[model samples]
Target: MNLLHANDQAGAYPPSYYAATRTPLAEFPALQGQIQADVCIVGGGYTGLSAALHLAEKGYDVVLLEAHKLAFGASGRNGGQVGSGQRQDQDWIEKALGREVAHKLWDLAEESKALVKNLIQNHQIPVTFHPGIAHACWTDVQVRDSHVYAEKLHRDYGYTHLETLDRVAIQNLIGSKVYKGGEIDRDAGHLHPLNYALGLAAAAAKAGTRLHERSEVIRIDHGATPVVHTATGKVVAKQLILACNGYLGNLAPNVAAKVMPINNFILATEPLGDRAKDILSQPIAVADTKFVVNYWRLSEDNRLLFGGGESYGYRFPDIIKTTSKPMLEVYPQLKGTKIDYAWGGTLAITMNRMPCFTRPYPNTLSASGYSGHGVAMATLAGKILAEATAAQSERFDLMASLPQQRFPGGAALRWPLLVLAMTWYGMRDRLGI
Candidate 1:
């Protein structure tokens, strides 16, 4: 089954809270006839939109095609936590690749956050960006390790935005007794993901990108001039960028091997009014130390936007029951709270959890497998892709150097292997191993 049309309707956005609250923009027409451009981007998510906007600013003709509306995929349907560092922490990167490379990666990560804020401010995007993300811990071992990492970041990295929180302090801040301890990164923040993505689309169009909605790429004839075939039209360009992330099916087999798609679910509670303060004393986003993480934050309308559920298959589970189970575990007081909305989204992941930035062929580059830290990283990747196209390759080369392993089992068996591995990890998470 085609995952692009698996759960959602064709040419429509999911019935998500983001869709309801987002400021709507005029939709672009579907591709028809033939088109040519300096660059043809196959996906219209953050990475594609970013590249489109940046390449347009550099005076390159850009064409961006989306299967649905702009930001209709994971770009609009994420936890919205703009995290710091790579998906794998700096320490892990340091162990895998040396300290020098790790430091370079850290600098690039910081640049990603700055690029996002600059875009929002410069373009006047209505998405309200906030600061502070608390990493809640379940065990004393996890708590102590977090404290040590905070100090290392400050001392070694010259970063001092993180504050270590004891158990009592964490409870006071989050209004939850489940957490043993935690640390808050004042540098990290959250925002309405869908609005932010739409803002990028508007900005890219204004900068001269020809964006076509409902223009799904059926295949790409890769060569000196790659021809991207949509249902009704085709785009032949000097360079091609594959930024589909989770929705990237078998279009590019080389990328599909390294990046596996997985589904995650979320739900939003009805307006909590004064009770919202009881769940989160502060307005920061909270993510706990679980293999399958539980992330949540209060929406601007005072609703608890909680995300936690797992599905290896293309389909999502029953929305309410699948998500509510984890939300109640964190805030049992919300047992009877009504869920106003629920949705599911797919994201790409690699074996090492670092993003997969690779050039599958000449004049063709693909950036995906961000895992869950796509908010900042994916947006920044667009800039890197644009730069590489413009013949500036420093930043893009640094990211492409990171290791990304292919799935052990090929096409037929990859999905089964991933399901088995995830089940084992989920069991360990429940056993607190």
Candidate 2:
């Protein structure tokens, strides 16, 4: 479905607390006539804005186009979990790539955490970035796996930021006995997502970047200097960055084929004052060890932001209960918490559970396939894409070198295959297998 209309069709961004608390800002004019820039970005989410901000800061004339307003995609409506690492675990990555490259990716992952903080500090984006994140396990075996993974990261990559909190510790943290045990990383945190998106857009404009909202790119013609065409006008540019991601639609065919758009949703509960402490010993964003992961965090005002259910199709789930029910399983203490607002966003996932950065055409860059781990990595992708545009293509090349497999069932069949796979995974999660 057209995500924006789908969102608003269901009263997506109702008078939620975030909307009430969001920063006031000016809107940019949509693309209307022919123009030129050093680079043109086709989406206004994190990756696109990051590229525009960085490139414009470097004195390159940059223009970014978004079919809807800024923060209209997953960038604004996600769980706000600014997590570390790829969607795949370190062991999974090491097995797919090599030890050395895996270590480098680990380094980048750590850098990704720092990069978010750096941007917030540099741009003064006040998004209530929470302190750290925790991973809870439903079973003893999952807890053991968490321990093993924690040890592996420290031993192999010399990274030691997380503390393995046992069942008792988990009990103390979340004030819950639902989880067997877990690990907590003070580095990975959650934030006010919409505020961050808006802040980044403001910074990009300040850096001499031109941003146009409700401006969709219909066609892109490639050459030494590419030309991007909208309905009423066109932009002839030195380079093109296709950061549309899940919103790419048919702008690039292979992109949609390899990176299928999946819907993950979030719900906000009425603010709880002292009762919020009853939910956790310490506040932190959380995801479980289950395949159909249950992720939750707290808003600055103490409202619980929970996200769990996922759909492979274009449409958002019709039932809000279907999405927030997972929250009860994770923290039964929240059983009585009143759910206020529930919204959905489309995020692209590659088959291999890894991001893909490739040049579909020379000078025409395509960076998508972030799976569910986009917050930090997408921002990093933008900088690397800008680097490539500036002739420093090594980092971007490293990301592009990571093995990417086409979605299992081609374009038409991929969604069905994903839904099938997710059903099995969801069943496993339900059975606690």
Candidate 3:
């Protein structure tokens, strides 16, 4: 089943809390007939939108096509945390790809966060960057490791925005007794994800990008001049960018080989009012240390927006049931709190949990498999795509040079294999091992 149409209606955003509270953008017309541009971007999420904005600002004739509404995928539905580093931490990156590459990647990650902030500030996007993300740990070993990692980031990377938190401190901050200890990254933060995407789309459009909603890319004729075909229209462009992420479908099988799509769910509780302080005292986001990580933060109106639960399938499970169990496990005080909205989204993940950046064809560039750390990286990926299209490819080449491996099984069997692996990992999480 095509994940774009598997669980949601055609040309409609999911019934997510983000959708309910989104700062609406006037819809762009769907593509018709044929068009030509310097760059054709597929998937109108963070990467594509950001790419369009940067490319258009650089005076490139850009056209962006979305299967549905902009930010209709994981970009809009995620936990909204602008995380500090890449999906994998520095130690893992250093061990896998040397210290120099790790340091460069660290600098790029820092630039990504700065880019997001700059975009919001420059465009005056109707979103607030609430700073601070707590790394809530369930085990003492994990807490120790987290503290050590925080120190490494400071000592080696010159990042000193992290504050160590013991069990008592964590419990007091998050109002949760489940966590043993952790650390808070004051540099990292959260925001209204969908609004941010909409702001990017608006900025891109204003920069002279031709954006087409409901313009799902069905095929691509790759060569010197790539042709992106939608159902009713096509874009012939000098360069093509595939930023589709999890909803990529079979557009490019080479990318599909390395990036596996998975389903995740999130729910928003009714406004907590005074009880909001009981949930999070300082309005910071919290992500726990679990194999299938649980992340949450408060909405502007004080509702708990918690995200968890994962399934390696096209169809979504009962989101409220799937997500509420984990949320309650972390904060049982919200046992009977009314769940105002529940929704599921598809996000791509790679074998090593690092993003997969590839040049599927000489004229085509693709970036996906952010593995849940896309809020900032995906935005940066767009800017990099713009730079590469503009003949400045140093950063793009560096990201593409990162070690990316295909799934153990090919696309046909990868889902089943992931299911088995995730089942085992989930069991271990329950067993606290």
Candidate 4:
């Protein structure tokens, strides 16, 4: 079964807390006839919308296609933490590609966060973008490493926003004894992901991006000029962008080989009132060092938005119980808290846990496999794609030069291989090794 249509209805958004709270947006018409544009973008999430807005601002005629509604996938449903740095730690990048390239990558990451803030301000998006993200540690080794990494960021990268917190400090901040230690990055923050996505769509539309909802891309024919086809229409463009991420099924075999999709679940508790403050004294999001990281923050209405479960298969598990079981472990006091909403979304991951930027064909480009740190990186990617299409490609080439390792097996057997690998890591997490 196609993962895109597996959990959600065609052209419908998932019943996520994000959707329930999102600001309403007028729906766009689906593509029903042949269309032409300078740039044809697939998938209308953060990446596609950002690209459309940036390109449209540059006077490029752009057409963006979404199989479902705007912000319907992971872009809208994820933990809204605008994280710091690249998905992999800077030390890892330094080790793999040396210091010079690592520094460039770090600069790009800093630009990513700044761009998000600028968009929210310039476009006047109504999303509540707050400050602080606490990275909690469960084991003492993790605690030691967390501090070491924090120090490296300061010494090596000149980043000074992170403050290390001891066990007592973390407990006081998060109201949880499970955390041994952690660090809070004041620069990184959280927001209402869906509203932010919708705001981007509105900005793109105003900038003259022709957006078509419910227009799923069935195939892409590459040449000097490419044709993107839907069931009822097609778009002929000089350049094509594949920004589908997890929802990119068999449409592009080259991308599917490297970027594998996985399902994650999130649940929101009923308005916790004063109880919410007791859980998180500071209004910062918290993500622990679990193999399946437990990320959570508070809603504007004082509800606890928690996300923790993972599924290798296409189907979602008992969303409430699976996520609540781990959540209760973190904050057992919330054992009886009413779960107001629960939802799941699919996101793509590369073998090296970094983004996969590929030039699959001469005129076709693709960006995906952001792992879990897509909120900022994906947005940056769209701008980079737009710049590259306009013949300015220094930054895009830097990212594409990063190694993108594919899964060991081919498309047919990759899922089974990933299951075995992720199973071993998950077990190690439980064993605290």
What is the C-alpha lDDT profile of model 4 across 1-433, one tens digit per residue? 6987888888887888888888989999999999899999999989999999999999999999999898788999999999999999998999999999999999999999999999999999988789999999999889999999999999999999999999999999999999899899999999999999999999999999999999988888889999999999999999999999999888788888989999899999999998888899999999999988999999989899999965668898889988998899899999888898999999989999989998998698889999999999999999999999999999899999999877888987999998988888888877888
Worst 10 residues of 4 by lDDT: 309-318
For each candidate, give its TM-score against the true structure.
0.99, 0.95, 0.99, 0.99
* Per-model RMSD to reference: 0.8, 1.9, 0.8, 0.8
Q: Give the C-alpha miss distance for residue 225 in model 1, angstroms.
A: 0.7
Model 3, residue 382: C-alpha shift (Å): 0.4
Query: Candidate 3 on 355-416: residue-level lDDT in tens?
Result: 88889996999999999999999999999988988989999999999888889877677888
Model 1 ranges off by over 4 Å: none
Compare the candidates by lDDT and give the number of the best one: 3
How well is each residue in 237-286 modelled by candidate 1, as lDDT tens digits?
99999999988898888888999888888899899999989888989999
The reply for model 4, stretches above 4 Å from the true place, is none
- Backbone clash pairs in model 1 (N, Cα, C under 3 Å; residues 3+ apart or in different chains), count: 0
State the lDDT at 406 in candidate 4: 76
| Cα lDDT computed for each candidate against the true fold | 0.92, 0.82, 0.93, 0.92
What is the TM-score (0 to 1) of candidate 2?
0.95
Ranking by lDDT: 3, 4, 1, 2
